[model samples]
Target: METAVASAASTGRAQTSRSRCRMSPKRYEAKLRLAEAFVRLVEAMPAERITVNMIAEASGKHRKTFYYHFADKEQLVVWLFRYDLASGLADKFPEDLLVREQDSPDNPLAEFPFYARRIEESGRIYNAPFFAALSYSLEKRRAYYRRIFSTRGPGTLDFYLHQLFFPAIKEDILFLIDREIGRQSAVERKALRERMTSNAGVDFLAEFYTGAFLSRFVERLNYTSARRTARDIIPFENVVHDSLAALIRQEIEKAAREPGSEDRPGKGGAPCASPA
Candidate 1:
């Protein structure tokens, strides 16, 4: 759900089990300790200033131990996202990082491509415990946002988050597509990777999704009526589910239809058209 963290982590690879999706209970706890310590440090110091030693000291673990759990601080932060979001779910969530779910409490992150896949594959994961877990996890993230981005903008917070989640959703869609098509051949996979990395067929679709969900998240976050909580997101559960499934399906179809380059990376920071 952390935008910066997600972009950094999206090397276009799925997280291996040893990281968190599948880890010994003890290992999960150890990593969680580091994650919590990092969050705690953020409460006092900027994330940029915090170092491995500081995080290790806070977790009461040695420095080398951090490397065992994570390849680098960025990777650790990636798990921090999963750890914080999933812990509240109490093992009811999937093995990877909980995404888009962060914004609307019911939203998706690559969170959705995989999330939509799961909901269709299994009915058990759609139970109340799942939402309950989200309630706790998202609130935790909200508090973190409040403190960390105090000066950023309550007004534009939704927009900023929308921007972040869109990429995750977009990349996740690509990741899913890669699973289906990229593995067919090494060359095809490279082309797929290069293709998806650019903002082609799926950019606007991701934008629509992130906007819809994140706006709802912002509204609930600042509702100012009967303090917002996880339950607030329950009514929208089915809407979110159907929306994600549809969005992903549409995107993949579009990509399949147009297998040529649509846009490149260096747009020279072209500005969006100004409002009239």
Candidate 2:
């Protein structure tokens, strides 16, 4: 009788442990689906318009199940921003040299096209709701930076990382739009030409308009001039093709090196999916 009782207790403990192990993967997968669905939904509409029911319906999960995983919509948005956006940014900045490369004058604006393509691809897979969610997430990120570093000196590393670098990337996109699409319009073309040709106008415009748009943050961050090396300027098309090809090769190598469904905890205990 004593041996049977001990055996039963051991079996129960093993079963409980196995059950928990099984549940962890299920929960992780559910969260992944939720994040993907949320991105789709936001692309279609603004984050404010998204509700628990919408997420549940899009993910094909019940509202109760979503509530079980996330406390509310705000929490879900926070998780997605911290895990998805931050991780993507980290992946792009794989090396310190990559950061410097971004600031190099010779580097073509091909990266912006890659991001635009990513957005379009996500839209096709999900919905407009995802883009709307991303916009709100970006706004929140900006507000967070403003609150944290509003009064502090601008020359800090934190200031550059949180304030200047990220916003500069966004501004670069706007710059590309001005150069490409905005120039095509006759009214904009004439105004831009007038503004550029005026005495000290280009510098003034760069300072006020281009620089001023992010002056609040840029004023605080340390500005370092890129090294005066003879950097090669690859054509935008070639750069895109090469960079993407390299990325694919790297991914293949990474998969061969690490092949398993290991639960790697990302920012905020979120499971980080391996690159496909």
All candidates' lDDT scores? 0.49, 0.37
TM-score of each: 0.48, 0.27
Candidate 2, residue 232: lDDT: 21
lDDT of 2 by residue, 113-227 (tens): 1121122321211112222332333444443333323333343222232332333333333333233323244533443323223334223322333233235223322222231
> Where does candidate 1 stray beyond 4 Å?
1-24, 86-90, 93-135, 148-202, 214-226, 241-276
Q: How many backbone clashes does candidate 2 have?
A: 19
Q: TM-score: which candidate is best?
A: 1
Alpha-carbon runs more than 4 Å astray in model 2: 1-27, 89-276
- In model 1, what lDDT does residue 23 have? 28
Give the per-residue Cα lDDT of candidate 2 at 268.
17
